[model samples]
Target: MNLYPVLQTADVAASARFYRVHFGFAPTFEADWYVSLRHPLAPHAEIALLDSEHPSIPDGYRERARGTLVNIEVDDVDALATRLDAAGVPVVQALRSEAFGQRHVIVRDPGGVLVDVITEIPPSAEYVAAFAPNE
Candidate 1:
């Protein structure tokens, strides 16, 4: 299965700029109130920047901080996090092995979106043996 992530931004224009300048992602779709951006390399990704001014935005969620908290799989989460942290990017989390066979970390973008950087790990023999215990 494929995965996608979306987040509500306090200001659509401001968020769009961050994606455009920092990530070089441009708008695939835009309106007076909303904009959806896509990375040139990741054409399938559709990260929609929700407008706070939009009529449908819930009041409660509006006050809550807007963050992505999205887990994006990479080749090496440790190296990626180090490079990002060295570049002055604040890492909300750190790389560590997870039960899902991955090491991951978190990033909070300018739009208040939290992105989780992940790298898949090979399944452990013990884990593979668990389901096949009877074998």
Candidate 2:
């Protein structure tokens, strides 16, 4: 499966900084409101933070919040949340224990893309069975 995210943002540089400093992504190409950053350890999609000044997305882009809210599944939600907060990126959803088997935090990017940072927790036997749904 092609599990990559191509997100839309208004501030390419800001988004690039967020990904680069927080997620360890280094940019390969950078232009006005256009950039490509990749993770050295894992496969990451090329994110494009469109410039609001010269928007190519047309009018009424964020009508119903269209586009990918990239879900960043991590191992340490709390730590990451703290880092993001300290970096001045407010968390939309505080780190919470999910009913399933994970902890998650939501944050909005420069272009209003909601990023869900998830950290999986050990699943209970019942939860596992329910998810497995097999005899």
Candidate 3:
């Protein structure tokens, strides 16, 4: 089964552009109050942006702020980070490599949702050795 995360944003178009310009997501469906995007390479990975003030949103949801994050796994974290930087997107967390074999960066979309853009990389020898089965 595929999972889709829906974000409530003040501006649906701006939020949609944030994903499209930075990550190359295309709109599968769009309206004045909502938009659904499909990942460029992984169709199963999807995101939806909805107007915070739209009637479809549950009552009182519009009054609360969005505090959740959306994680996107890509093939090249650095490349995507560069593109986002060139486009003037603000990075909340600098690109860094982790011991868990992931290179990632954190940025806030226009909707104020934190998005973690990540890609897998070769793990450090120490990390691998630590997890290696006892010889």
Candidate 4:
């Protein structure tokens, strides 16, 4: 199954640009009320932006997303963090290594989505036992 997130935002174009600039996504489709983006090297990685008030969305569910965090795995979280900092992107969570084997940073997108950029790292000794046997 193919799964991708469709963000409902007030400004679809601005939201699309934010992903393109910060996450290396290129637009596959674009319209005033919607846009679809895919990573050039990873076409399976996709995201869509839609006008929050689009008629197709049920009225009750058309509101902007809240309490949602999108995780995007990358090869180098530290380098991305530095680039984002240089570009003045707001970092909600500073770059840090987690005991569960992740080096990551959290940033808020223009549409208020929390994007957790991450890289896999060796798990801390103390946390290694928490993983399932196969893992």
Candidate 5:
């Protein structure tokens, strides 16, 4: 089974461009009211954007996502951080290395969804035992 989150936004095209330009996602399906995107290297990872006012969504539910975070793991988050800075994208959470095996930065997408860009790193010694062993 495949699962992906759909974000409701005021402008589907602008939201689509946010993912495409900043995160390297390309639209697999595009429509005036919706767009489906996938990263070329990770085809299984997908995200969809829908017009918040689109008729298909129930009237009461046609609002932008709130307090939702989408995490995208990459090979080199520091480099991506530099690129994002160059592009003038604001980083909500400054790039930092975590004890729990992640080097990440957070930014808000056009629709107000928090996007956490991460790169995996070896966990700090004190936190290493907290992770389950790989099967």
Candidate 6:
């Protein structure tokens, strides 16, 4: 199954622009109250922007309280972070390299969603050896 996350926002157009301008996402579908974006190169990578007032959303979520964290994997986390920094996007968490061979940064989207932008890197030697197959 494919998973397409929907981020409810106060301004659907603004949020759509944010993703498009900063993350290279293109709108596959758009409307007055909703927009669906797909990565320019990766068609399977998708996220939807929905106006908070959209009726399809449950009453509980209409208040704009979302607990989900969106994770986006990129080829270069540092480069994206630099561009985002220049564009005035606030970084929720500083860039850090994980033991599992990933460099990531956390940023808050226009819709108040936490997005973890990650790129795979070489894992620590210890971690690599730990996951090695038995001889």
Cα-based lDDT for every prediction: 0.68, 0.73, 0.85, 0.90, 0.91, 0.86
C-alpha displacement of 15 in model 3, angstroms?
0.6
Predicted model with the maximum TM-score: 5
Candidate 1: lDDT over CA atoms?
Answer: 0.68
Model 2's lDDT to the true fold? 0.73
lDDT of 2 by residue, 15-36 (tens): 7788888778888778875687
- lDDT tens digits, residues 1-135, model 5? 889999999988988998999888899999999999998884568999999999999878989889799999989999998998888886899999999999999988878889899999999999989999999
How well does candidate 2 match the true structure, expressed as C-alpha RMSD? 3.6
Q: In angstroms, what RMSD does candidate 1 have relative to the true structure?
A: 4.7
User: Can you list the residue pairs that collide in candidate 2?
Assistant: none
Estimate, for each residue in 1-135, the C-alpha lDDT of model 4 and write its tens digit. Answer: 888999998889878988999988999999999999999894469999999999999978988878989899999999999999898888999999998999999998888889999999989999899878875
For residues 1-135, what per-residue lDDT tens digits would candidate 6 score against the true structure?
888888889889988888899888999999989999999784568999889988898787685536878888898999999988889888989999999888999988888888889998988887887565749
| TM-scores for every predicted model | 0.67, 0.76, 0.84, 0.91, 0.93, 0.86
Count of backbone collisions within predicted model 3: 0
**In candidate 6, which residue ranges exceed 4 Å CA deviation?**
129-135
Between prediction 2 and prediction 5, the one with superior lDDT is 5
State the lDDT of candidate 3 residue by residue for 52-132, as single tens digits. Answer: 999877786784236797888888889889988888888999999998778999998888898998997878876786565
Error of 5 at 95 (Å): 0.7
Query: Model 1 over residues 1-135: C-alpha lDDT tens digits?
Result: 745455666777876776665455779888757788877774455577776656687666554245337656666677777877876767777667876467888877766777787887765666765453445
Best-first order by TM-score? 5, 4, 6, 3, 2, 1
Distance from true position, residue 58, model 4, in Å? 0.6
Model 4 root mean square deviation, Cα atoms: 1.7
Task: Please list all clashing residue pairs in model 4, or write none if there are none.
Answer: none
Clash count for each candidate, listed in order shown: 4, 0, 0, 0, 0, 0
